[model samples]
Target: MKKYCFGVDVGGTTVKVGLFTVEGQLLDKWEIITRTENNGENILFDICESLEAKLDEKSIDLDEVKGIGIGLPGPVLDDGTVLQCVNLGWGKFNVSEKMSEMFHGIEVKAGNDANVAALGEAWKGGGKNFDDIVMVTLGTGVGGGVILEGKILTGHNGAAGEIGHMHVEDGEELNCNCGGCGCLEQYASATGVVRLANRYIAKNSESTKMTEFGEDITAKDVFDLAKEGDKGAVAVVEQMSTYLGKAMASIATVVNPQAFIIGGGVSKAGQYLIDAIADVYVKYAFPACREAKIALAELGNDAGIYGAAALIV
Candidate 1:
């Protein structure tokens, strides 16, 4: 007898859905525009309808499907309750129960999107072969997910891997969008890189491509210039790595994963980024844990879908 599963990654713009065999082979995947109007009321219905259509198109029996796994853009409790999804316009609610009811009692498991992505990486990406993994996603904002011994540490409120909010600096009183000061996100995210670059530019009018890009500069541009040995961009990347390395070092003390898998858009900078971060991590890490590895995530956008699908298994 063959088995199948469905994975859903609910995002602000679109909901990614994947169909996979129970053995972790992805059969098909598609996307649907997330209708977030009216507090995301249509999101769940949209997912179920999409899955139903896929099943009909594939001529697959509903009984052969084990369950549906979903990764939401918010904190999800073990009971499938979502505390809130700011991007999806959702308030506190039980996502798993509603999804299960929508799918006619099919088992539904839910988790935070970043956490789910971490699980995907652990299973098949950079963290493969390592049961304990910590994933840091450096996109528009920094996100983190922790998987220890093949299990996600969701914490009491499902906020265990929220590494972006870690307070790294003490004198930064301007406050972050999360209403905190000196957060790791403020210094290590894509936007954060631009901020660091501008400060460096202001301090020294160095001849580099980063300064030429003006305020429109991006993290990629900085890294690109750094790869060419540009002094200013190298400084910016070094600074960003400093904060991220320190944060990961602190995380290593508790989560103590075998590897720190770096993902997200910023990670596109490639090996130099990993080298920079690893250099600083080694300096701040506990003496006994200095050997923990740092590597880039293999799956790009598909990690969340794979992870959400894994939730059912």
Candidate 2:
């Protein structure tokens, strides 16, 4: 009987690898550098070497390993074909097939990083109790994943849960990294919060504490001030919550997830942020969807590995 499995989350700078029991308990975890040189040709080789070393160190035989699940920073089709991953210098290819070949016929599964993270949450994190959930990661940029009936929903092109690029405003001059204007990522992400704070400070000469941080102001600072009842900071936080909540409400109408799990660096704001966004979410959400729970992700950074393992475990 298979007793173990491996989870690999490939990011731009590093790859997080986790070894787990067939029963879902993590046995070991580590990280390896992601060599993006030569179009990331060495990425798989590096991961394979790392896993081999790990297995050898643990004295685990290949016969006892079940499978390997990998999450990539790009759109990944159901068959494990990655359309593109510019950050990793990767192009269209069957990642699962390649990795399986490198692993000498071991089973391998693949998925988009964000979606796999959501799957991890659904399987072992905040949304584990719920059958359907939408996970929003408010980091440098907004990332999202949808889990329906406990399955990752990777739309026709593997871009199903890209809630960050959902248009939230009109007539905006600035373009998001995705080449879109007024996207949710532009106003709801960590940088988006800073942008809102800066825009507010620039427009209204408010004698607020935010100015103390000056140009280095971050999303955490904004939230801290907002929690302290600073008017300008409150406005900025409210605006961001409004955009995020409204976008989630729109998503509710379509997927009607049972919950929205907020994760990432920004989620460190804690329950206060959840309450603030929940207030706006209720107002904008359909009456039937208003009951959806808004909670913080419990898995933190581990969600990616857990979700990746879920692909095959």
Candidate 3:
């Protein structure tokens, strides 16, 4: 390992960049617009150029940097090959190799964004001080990363921690983007909470403060109303928590992590969401693993950069 490193997180809208000490301390961070035009041919070029400018601005030479670690918003094979990333207009290619070549053989490592985020939490966020932990990102869709013995379990197809796609509701008919039905993502994600609340009011004709929000209802709305003792909203929150907890429990039977770190926009609900999920997790968790703690992720948007830096750390 070297003394300094560069961490880059590629997203659809922008690319997040970070300068870090090999000791795992972030020194500085910044972002640049991601031009997805022309098949995103400029994406890597932009990142490389941005690094050059950043290094020059800091009066640092490229020789001082150990390597570049990047997290991509897509499935990344063990060889750092990206299958595809619709948001970034990326297709199949060995990202690590290409990046290393662009950087004049300094070094480069790449991984799935969610998995890297898990590595981030494990390294310096909520999962810090624990060697085995899993990170669940509850965004528009659910994303997961499993870390055991302080390493990510990328799995045979680089899809081990696809916890959102885990089968939870077998009877549901809605298809997940992954071409599956009754996925945990459908009921456990932020969008799932709103969908559940709407379903409850529709199926039971229950009066909820939620109805007042109409099309404006959100997962936060459901949790807020639930906290205020709204029956319909509480039920919806509980339902989402139940499925989420159950999914975690099932995950434990395999990886048996010491803790679960919850992140993403929905996690803003804080303790309320963690407690709700933990309540149901106990029922489904293996006896030995039932005590696994659920906690909020400490790193937010910065998690990607932190985890990316960790790849080279």
Candidate 4:
């Protein structure tokens, strides 16, 4: 007689699923590889099969499931159609409709991954106490989510919290996957950090600890070297922080959320990254906005599933 819901976070390489109680307690979780080669339709079949196996193994009845929520990597239209998923090669698919059919009429809700992550943080992670929060994921590319008055803010085109695509530099061309240049993502994301580091090394080859790693270095390697007091690494970190802070400042001017929660792999850089970025963020922000609290995301990699669960809760 216990009520439960399933939260599915669909990524390019993996699909993470979490079983949660109606009250938001995560009871069990699992993941499966997402095979997109057979077309997007096969992905749903694999997920349905995986979910059935997991539920059977746990002796959970399908009747007890209240709903299924999904967090997708691309933009979802207002009418429950997915516009496109560049990573998944899915375009204009009816995700929610397909999911409901797969689950035999169970209720289903779908949203962008960043928005779900923000909702997850608001429900149980870093933004637990605040009704207004902005969550930023600084990974391969930057992604953002906005929660206002306890609701996810999806704009007219369902692309509301796309802070990464915000233009930071005017008339300065830098290639972005969104087909634009000078995007904030190009400077503030982990990919951006590596790009900046590589550029620095290309120009200052003899003056950097990056020279030790040859041509193939990563953002983590840069952070490690920075911790070791490498001058070049330190410079890269500072520059990265400056750009990140600048982006935060711009975000603050618009949304002015109560808190900014930073997540994703790069966030593991810890206080070194946070403190440095905050130092510059305060300098660039407006008087009242500068007081906004900055914090690290508590959920780690599981944030997506938790966030998806939040949609139902």
Write down the TM-score of every candidate.
0.98, 0.99, 0.97, 0.94
Q: Between which residue pairs do clashes occur in model 2?
A: 120-307
For model 2 the local lDDT of residue 228 reads 95
Error of 1 at 154 (Å): 0.5
List runs of model 1 lying over 4 Å from the truth. Answer: none
Q: lDDT per residue, candidate 3, 111-178, as tens digits?
A: 99999999988999999988899899999999999988877789888998999999898789778888
| Tens digits of per-residue lDDT for model 2, 140-244 | 999999999878999999999999999999967899999989999999899999999998999875667888888999999999999999999999999999999
Candidate 4 TM-score over all chains jointly: 0.94
Which window of ten consecutive residues has the lowest lDDT sum in model 4?
Answer: 166-175
Model 4 deviation from native, Cα RMSD in Å? 1.7
lDDT of 1 by residue, 24-53 (tens): 889999999999999888989988999999
Best by TM-score: 2
As for TM-score, the candidate ahead, 1 or 2, is 2
Output the number of the lDDT-best candidate.
2
* Model 4 global lDDT (CA atoms, 0 to 1): 0.85
TM-score of 1: 0.98
